[model samples]
Target chain A: MDDKLPGTLPGSRRPGRGPRQAQEIYRATLELLGGGGYDALTVEAVAARSGVNKTTIYRWWPDKDALLGAAIVQSSLLRFDVPDTGTLRGDLSGLVHRLVGLMTGEATSGVVVAALAAVAGRPSLAWLAREFVTDRLAGERAVFDRAVERGELSGSVDPALVLDLLAGAVWSRVMLRQAPVPDDFADEVVKVVLEGCAVRA
Target chain B: MDDKLPGTLPGSRRPGRGPRQAQEIYRATLELLGGGGYDALTVEAVAARSGVNKTTIYRWWPDKDALLGAAIVQSSLLRFDVPDTGTLRGDLSGLVHRLVGLMTGEATSGVVVAALAAVAGRPSLAWLAREFVTDRLAGERAVFDRAVERGELSGSVDPALVLDLLAGAVWSRVMLRQAPVPDDFADEVVKVVLEGCAVRA
Candidate 1:
């Protein structure tokens, strides 16, 4: 997820600060989102709960959707970094596993889906969603780029498409609830996607 | 996609009926949706605009969501049936092309995304979205099954996974808008997926 918080205060938190105020604001946002899906969440509630002024929130986020987007990125997706296990399979599988872990969690899933709904038609929020996904994919793209460098993958391979295929499959399972994401599903997908499933024994 | 409307009244239109009233209802629903999105659409408004009694709409559809869901399915997804080409390549590409057509259209894309947002947190609407996807995949699954029977695919291949890969790729392009669904993107995806990207020439 994109780490650049909109209108972030750089180096503003002095050494005497007891705790980063942004952390408190994020916690309040997540709590409100969990308690009342997306509709009931408001900047006023966030301010009341976080003890931060509403103007500060607006100055940083510009809107509720932006605040929620930043909070979600900070809370959930920021945890995973790109994996480099020396093989495409290892790296891909690791990425999928990390995603599976997040999707399977109740709190994260609630926040994620609610956030998507909150941003559905609004152009700015939609752009934020696209940016978040793109930023998260950057890590996986690194793995693919490395594979290309090592000649494990063709230099012409579209890292974006590769990431889309892998991520989309998981999204279908988790968001659409068509099927469960089994422990081995990622490995199977990586194998088929990498090696082609058409030529079977 | 799913031809089965949840509570469709078949042959309910009598001989004296000049034009089907359901069409009017659906048109009004779409108009309201296009103007104000899912939040502004109401059965009462549909009734007022279409001149259909609110009681009648309620009789046919249990609630506003059911009405909107039915209207969306009727207006959009119902029109596209699955393609049956002689080969998996043809079938997959055809399916992707059909989806690209819908996603690229302004009206359909608006309705589709609005419907998803309307159903995001609600269990019943979520179920409807899941059902819609599952029903759509059934057609693609048929193509895969036929390929296996024709010895074009391995008998051990997972039909669900194949559908997931294809549909997921399209969903990524359309829903995530990460990349454009180039005219040849489907063909490229089919080739890579079928032949395996791992072993490049």
Candidate 2:
């Protein structure tokens, strides 16, 4: 999804920075976002906080939304690294566990709630929310793809529905209900969804 | 949820009114909410718009949150009349169809989006959002209870998870993605979830 950002300046144009610089910039972005929200976030503020040149930030990210999008993609909030646990159930369980941690984590969850609040408050940033969810969905699709290849799931199963069910249950429990998720939540969701899809397949 | 409102006045203590008057009040509340959001909603405006006495409105609902909560429950946006289709699949499908309509309908969807925006913007009113979801979940639980009684589903199945998945997927599609749900979405979700739970049971 970061690849879809508007400006992808050439590597040569970058000021010969290391990954440490990029991490600093993203951290500053999230910190500013968490503190004052989207309206408070600006390329100039991020540059000042991270000591990165504003011109360099603009050279890579075209606008504030692009910068925030990139920062969110780099954040723990949107990381959807597919797990290859050899079985569909195991892979899903691993993914759900990571999601639970992200939602429950102190620093990460605050950033997430802030971002969502920003999007909810501003209609213009609705695209960012959509893009964020779409990107994560795309990343999570790999698990189902691998499951299909391994013959654990038939191609007939709807990956979107499966992923939505899994993540939705967690969102409902964590965000909506504002209740403690049981220790076995990830395993239970994975078990039911995998069994449901397997039977349908 | 409306019953859980802070103050519920007795029938004998109020002014005489018919269902039409209550409907007018709810309609006015929704209109104000849909127009200017939560900040614009007030007991005074609702009374003016509905032509009901402010004292009477206050007698029934103590404050703005209570009024808004009651209006929401009375609106089609939160109705969760469980279907008795004789089978869990049929009942769930019916419920999902109604949910999809509420999310997709031109008028109802706007009210839903407005109410959600209000809740998201104001942290204090988060209880309203939580109560709204909890109420709907409680109402929808009847389907599972009936299915259990008929032996179609084991009591082991998680009703909360099931409802979350169904509503969550629709929300993801209609609100998050701003995408049109496929015609068969309800049926597809019901089929997979029921088959999945059946296998687990």
Clash pairs, candidate 1, are A194-B198, A195-B196, A196-B196
- In order, what fnat does every candidate score? 0.57, 0.36
- Tens-digit lDDT track for model 1 on B53-144? 88887766766776666666555433587788898788878877877777667657766566656666555566566666665666567888
Backbone clash pairs for candidate 2 read: A196-B196
Name the top DockQ candidate: 1
Clash number for each model: 3, 1
The local lDDT score (0 to 100) that residue B111 gets in candidate 2 is 77
* Model 2 residue B29 CA deviation in Å: 3.0
Report DockQ per prediction, comma-separated.
Answer: 0.51, 0.36
**lDDT (Cα, tens digit) per residue for candidate 1, span A1-201:** 554343222222222232357778888898787677777889999999999999887766767776776676565433587788998889988887877676567657666566656666555555656766765765567887788888888878887777777777776677655356777899988877898878554
Q: Candidate 2 — which residues are off by over 4 angstroms?
A: A1-22, A39-62, A120-123, A197-201, B1-22, B40-48, B51-62, B120-123, B197-201
Candidate 1: Cα lDDT at B31: 73
